[model samples]
Target: MAPKVTVLDYGAGNVRSAVRALEHVGAEVKLSRDPQDIREADGLLVPGVGAYAAVMDALKASGSLRHLGYRIAGGRATMGICVGHQVFFEAGVEHGVRTEGLGEWPGVVERLPAPVVPHMGWNTVQAPEGSRLFEGIEDERFYFVHSYGVLEWNFDVTQPAMRPPLVTWAEHGAPFIAAVENGSLSATQFHPEKSGDAGAALLKNWMGTF
Candidate 1:
């Protein structure tokens, strides 16, 4: 059976493309904001496109915040994209406005220190060793459209027996997180749904983890 993946529909933007992308990757996709679906699916995809504060408001307004926390705390498989990926951090500061995020990791989302603001278009990422998501597409470029990002990563597993998260990096004017694979949680700063063939292969690789 295909992996049951639920796409969180918290009114971020047009998520039909993400739905189509997941389906193309052989996932049994379901579009919903239901807490039950969020918890029970084999994988949950949190997708977003827009400002950081607005995305958090939508997630809170729809009562997805707690359930998402619950899902992640339980170590279930979850993936975030774009602003969805941004909200995994402790906070995001956009245009002088500071908004709290899910705090899944210790970091702050700030404006990219780049001559070009949005960091739009195709760019290659330096995937860490042992990354399952970039298995076949390690050298390929993926689509990105964002201004704010976690410029630094400070989260660490203090225990000697635990493995550190695999972080992928890409640069505009300075290096920023491109993607992260931390145990049951994974996320990307780019839109796999819009990345054409390379993106499809990435989605396929993620589904393999399910």
Candidate 2:
């Protein structure tokens, strides 16, 4: 049977593109705000677009965040896109407010310093050796538009880190954590759906993992 993947809907996110991407990859996909839908999914895709605090609150209010932890802890495959990636960290320091994150990974979501509030446009990403998601996918460019990025994390050390530590694949002239993967959980600060062929291939690779 094809893996059933759920694209989380927290109201603060635009899940249509992700849903289309997953469908394009041959997986059975659904847009769900219910906790049960997430619990039963073979893989989960958390996609978001909006402020850190508002998105966090929407996830909690929908009860998807709590169930997301359950899915990850159970060894199920999961992925976070853009702001969705930020919410996986311990907290987000945006707009002078500190909001709690899912804390699945040990990191803090912080804004890019001066001259780089929102890193927009297409950029390249290099996956380190032995990365499952980047198996056949080469160093390709993808679309990214975001103001905040994952600054640092301790979770990468305790467990086997994915991609690389402290190396920026491509950014607005500065390096930052572009992508991260640990076990079955993975995240990228870019929009794979908007990345054209390269991005589609990356999404295909992720679904193929299951």
Candidate 3:
């Protein structure tokens, strides 16, 4: 059977393209706000658009936030896209307002240091060696449209038995996280849904992990 994936629909918009893209890659997609479905799907995709604080509020209002936390903490397969990716961090500071995030990792999503706001367009990412997300398309460019990002990475697994996250980088006046492959969780600053063939391959790669 095709991998069963649930795309969290907390009214953040821009989710239809993601749903279409996932289906194009053979995923059985379900767009839902149901918490049980969120926790039990073979893979869970959190797709977000718009401001950081607004996205968080929507997730909370729909009661999907707690279940999202549960799924991630339980080490089930989960992927975040765009603002969905941003909320994985501890906090996000947009328009001088600081909002708490899912805290899946330690870092703050801040405005890019570049003179250009949004940093919209296609760009290549420096995928780390052994990165499964960019496996076959390591040299290809992906779509990106956002102004805020995690400029620095501080999450390091100190335990000798644990593996650290494989981080990818892209620049817009300065370097920022492009994608991350950390255990059961994976995220990309770029939108694979809008990334064309390369994005489909990337999504297919993630599905292969399940």
Clashing pairs in 1: none
Q: Score each candidate by Cα lDDT.
A: 0.93, 0.78, 0.93
Candidate 3 TM-score to native: 0.97
Please state every model's RMSD to the true fold in angstroms: 1.1, 2.8, 1.0
Candidate 3 per-residue lDDT over residues 44-138, each given as its tens digit: 99998899999999999999978988898899999999999999989999889999998877889999999888899999999999999999899
Q: What's the candidate order when arranged by decreasing lDDT?
A: 3, 1, 2
- What tens digits encode model 2's per-residue C-alpha lDDT throughout 85-187? 7887789988788999887667787777648557888877767777766666667778899988776545454456453333334455455677777778888
RMSD of 3: 1.0
Poorest 10 consecutive residues of model 1 by lDDT?
Answer: 155-164
TM-score of 1: 0.96
TM-score order, best first, reads 3, 1, 2
Clashes of each: 0, 0, 0
Higher lDDT: candidate 2 or 3?
Answer: 3
